[model samples]
Target: MRIATGGIAQETNTFQREPTTLADFERPGFGVVARGEEILDLEGTGTVYGGVVAEAKALGVELVPTTYGGVMPGGRVARSAFDTLRDEILVALRAALPVDGVLLVLHGAMALEDHDDGEGLLLDAVRDLVGPDVPIVAPLDLHTNLSDAMMAGADAFVGYKEYPHVDMPRTGARALQILAATVRGQARPVMAHARLPLIAPNQSMVTTWQSPLKIAIDRAREIEREPGVLAATVLGGFPFADVPFAGVATIVVTDDDPPLARRLADELATICWDRRAEFAVRPVPVDDAIAEAMAAPPGSVYVLADIADSGASGTAGDGTVILAGLIAAGARSAAVAQIMDREAVAACIAAGVGSTVTLAIGGRHDNLHGPPVRVTGAVRSIHEGGFALAGPMGAGTRSSRGRTVVLEIGGPGGIEVQLTEVRGHPHDLNYFRAFGIEPTERRILVLKSAAHFRAAFEPIATKVIEVDAPGISSANLANFDYRALRRPIHPLDAGARWSPGA
Candidate 1:
């Protein structure tokens, strides 16, 4: 049996001003440029494609890779860019017709300039071409905005349980294995979905350990191992997408048993909605977080999570609120990865290493986060800006920060500020390690991330605090002017309540 597989993935943050283009996908970050059998090179490496190849090899099925290209989470994709990627996948799949099954690696929250339900549209087109007899299984990211069109088109779905998504390869293996079984007539997978009217912040959704989301996901896994159950998935959903389906979702698949699927899906759905309050947490105020960080004991690494300026959520990554507070409070032994200031980095490069350079750091993108501050510092190091993920999330992928530099500001174990040409978040500690900076050596490690950083920085950190700085991706959802999101949603609409709608 041959299973066609490939996907175009992007998390569209409508609140972000920048527009994700085809050129962005060709950049050194997240974009993997391989097509057809050339994609087989990813077999033994890290990624969903690697798992697909491994599973197919073991299952004795030919894994026909159509194409795979995904960019970092960013603004709404241009319609032209979306069609180019989607059409390429479609054309490849058409050429590899008469496949027994199909497996897709998709991020469910994507949106285009013209199509709000980007994945839904893609799935609908694929379903039309393949027909209903061909079972389709899609592995989705944990932060997905699952829609009705997705449930209608795909036969089964699986999503990452961990927020950092360390289980990506495992999730891909599971999807392909399930499809392999279904194709061999050993299993008949039937799926049921339940969409909760709750949308919560991503800060508390880490599934590596016990939390509200973990509790529910753990319970779902327990039920998934039952005799008739095939798989269970809970998506916390991406709220910044400003789509109608931007809320919590649950999907349960069973071996030819719709009732079992429905029952398990409802059970997990109730668990998520029951702990709605826990998911709607508020970030600690910036000033409060700063004071606490300043007063921390020596030899401690406090991970100050700057959620607002998180480049992972498509923010420009040049916000100055947290850095300004840290400097003003006379905090020492601090290191921050990155405030994306192209001009600042260029000036430092021209000034040469060890030269005292006076430049305005951060806040260069927009006024949402605060204006730039003049910082007089010596250039510590400069690198061309490329690193591999030694972290839990996307661990083996090669990533780029684009012409990065380290500048020493303030005095006494001075603040090391990493500046980048691109607006990429310091999700992994390797970003600092690439420049010979040790993160554990610093008293305060400031990361521009919401929760993804915890996977890497948590091990070395003495404490972790989320800051409510003003920006597009702030933990405080009220900060955004959301126009398309369905109202009466949790947190955004505090008094809102929900249950499975008939």
Candidate 2:
């Protein structure tokens, strides 16, 4: 049996300042943009693409090559770039005709310039090319925004079960397993969805495997043990995407049973919604959080999570509200993981390490994440940033910070800020250790991530306090002027109500 696979993946934040372009995908820093059997090289690793390879090889099936392009989290993908990659995947699939099945790897929450339903649009195009007979299965990010059109196009969908998404490879493996079963005429997979009017804040969507989400996922797993059920997926939609389909969703795939799939999906979605309040979060104000960090006990580190400027959520990593507050409160033994400002890094490099410099770092991108704070500091160190991941979040993966500088702000504040040439989320401790700074030894470690940092920094943190700073990915969705989201959604609209469609 032969299976064709490859795709373009990106989680679009419509509000982000920078436009996602073709160049971004070609050199994504962390991973290479692959083509042809080049996709085979990505297999059997920790990534989702690797899992797809594992399954095909295990089944001893021929895996056809297709192009794959992915970009980091940012604004709506430029139509030209989207077209270039979309056409590449479609054309490749068209040329690979006569395959037994197809496996698509996509970030389900993607939004292109004209089409907000990116995965749905891509799936529709693939379906049209392949016709109705070819069994198509895809594994999606847990942060997928489910759409009706997407459901119409694909035979089944496999969504990641973990946040920080350690389960990517397993999800991909599962997708191929189903595709193989279908090819052998063993299991007829029928997919159904129970959509919810919920856009959960990233902070509340933690799957320590013990939250309300855990209860729903556990029940779904239990149901998967049933004879007819194939898979059940609960996706916490990305709120940064201002689209009608952007909301929490439950997808269930059953073997030759539509009614059972719908029923299980409905049950899973209801359980998640009933515990919706547990997902609501109120962040501590920046000034207060800074003050608390200052007063923290000796030998303790306060993990200050500045989620508003979360690089993972497609926000510029130049937020200064928390840093400004820390300076005003005269902080000590503090270090902020990163501020992405190429200009600032260049200025520091020009000044040279160990030289005293008066610099205004950050706030160059936009006004949403606060203005650049003026600090007179000495350049502590400089490096061409590259680090290897330790685990939980992209374990064993390599990430780059580009050209980086550590600024040791003078005076009583004693704040150290890391400035990078590029904007990448600080999900792992490598962001700090790679630059010669010890994260655990610091008094206050400011992380520009939501829940992902918890994978590495949580265990050692005396207390983790989320700060409600200013940025595109703010926890308070009400802060943004939303134009495209469907009216009266949860948390946004207090009286919002929803029931699954029949």
Candidate 3:
């Protein structure tokens, strides 16, 4: 049997003003595009492709690799960029005709300038080419904004159960394994989908032990063990996307058991919806968070989670609310992971290392994040901004922020700030280590990340505090001016209600 695989994956934040262009995908660090045989290089990696390749080999199936393009989560993808990626995948799949099945690696929340359901449309086109008889299975990020077109175009979906997405490869393996079974005539997978009028903030949806999301995920896992059940997935959905279908969703796939699938899907959806109030959590006030960090003992590290400016959720990574707070409090032994300011980076680069430069930093991308703050600091170092992931999440993958310039805020060992030309995820320790900052030695670390940081930072942190700030990815959904999202959503509309058939 032959299984064709590959996809274009991205998680879009519609509130971000910048458009994700073709150049973004072509970039070396944060973006990746693998075609045909080149895709085999991902065989033993931690990505979804790695899982698919390993499973195919074990199942003794010919793996037909198509085109796969994945860029960092950001604003709506430009129409031209989306078309180019989709065409590449379609062209490759067309050449590898008569495949037994297809396994797709997709970030189900991807959106484009002209399309709200990017994965749905891609699946539709692939379904059209492959026909109904060929089973198509996909593994989605846990934050998928499940859409009807997605359900209609694919036979089955398996979403990552972990929030930090540490289980990406496992999710991929499950998807391919299920597809292999269906293609071998051992099982017929039927899927049922249920979407709720609920939008949980990314911070509140962390699947850390006993988290509210974990409770629902555990129940889904329980159902998956039932007879005839193939898989169960619960997607908390990406609220920042501002799409019509931006909410929580559940999918249940069973072997020729439509009734069972629908029952399990509805059960899981209701379980999540019933506990929706728990997901409406508020972060600690910025002042309190800063004060707590300042008071922490000098030996250990304290983490301030700047959720609103989270790069993982598609913010510009230039929010200065927390930075301003830290500076105002005259906090020592503190470090801000990053602030995306091309002008500031350029100025620092021009000033050269060891030279002092005064410039306004951050708050240039979106007004909601806060205005820029002026700072005079010596340029500690300049780097090309490339680093390999040393953590469990995407361990073998490489990432870059494009020309990082470090600035010592007060003095040599005072508050250090990493200013970059591009947005960055400081979830991993290597992000700071690569730029000459030792996370373990620092008393306080300010990170522009929601929950993903916990996977790497929590282990070493004395205390992790979530700080409330203003930005597009803020947990306070009311702050956003969302016009495209479907009305009567929870939290936004207190009267919003949902039932199995409603």
Give the top-scoring candidate (TM-score): 3
In candidate 1, how many Å is residue 303 off?
Answer: 0.6
Worst 10 residues of 3 by lDDT: 204-213
lDDT of 2 by residue, 1-502 (tens): 9899988789999898577888888764643578997888877567887788887888898899798887778888888988888899888988989899999889898898888988888898888889999999999888888889889988999888877777889999999999999999999999889877777887777776376676787888888898898889988889888988887899999999988998889989999888887777799998889888888788889999999898888888899888888888888999998899898899999999898988888888888889988888989999987778775667656777789999998543388899998788877778888888888888999998877788778787898898988888787877778788987888788877866553
TM-scores, all candidates, are 0.97, 0.96, 0.98
Candidate 3 C-alpha lDDT tens digits along 1-502:
9999889899999998898888998898878988888777888777888787888889898889888888888999999998998898888889999889988889999999999999988999999999989999999999999999999999999999997888888899999999999998999999998999888898777987676778889999999899999999999899998889998999999999999999999999888888988888689999999888888766969999999888988898999999899889998888898999999999999989999998899999878799999998889999999999888688888889999998998996689999998898787899899999999989889999988999999899999998998888899988888888888988889789899856
lDDT of 1 by residue, 132-183 (tens): 9999999998889989999998988989888777778888899999999999
How far residue 186's Cα lies from its native spot in candidate 2, in Å, is 1.2
Ranking of all predicted structures according to lDDT, beginning with the best and ending with the worst: 3, 2, 1
Better structure of 1 and 2 per TM-score: 1
- Which stretches of candidate 1 lie above 4 Å from their native place? none
Model 3 CA deviation exceeding 4 Å by range: none
Ranking by TM-score: 3, 1, 2
Q: Candidate 2 vs. truth: CA RMSD?
A: 1.8
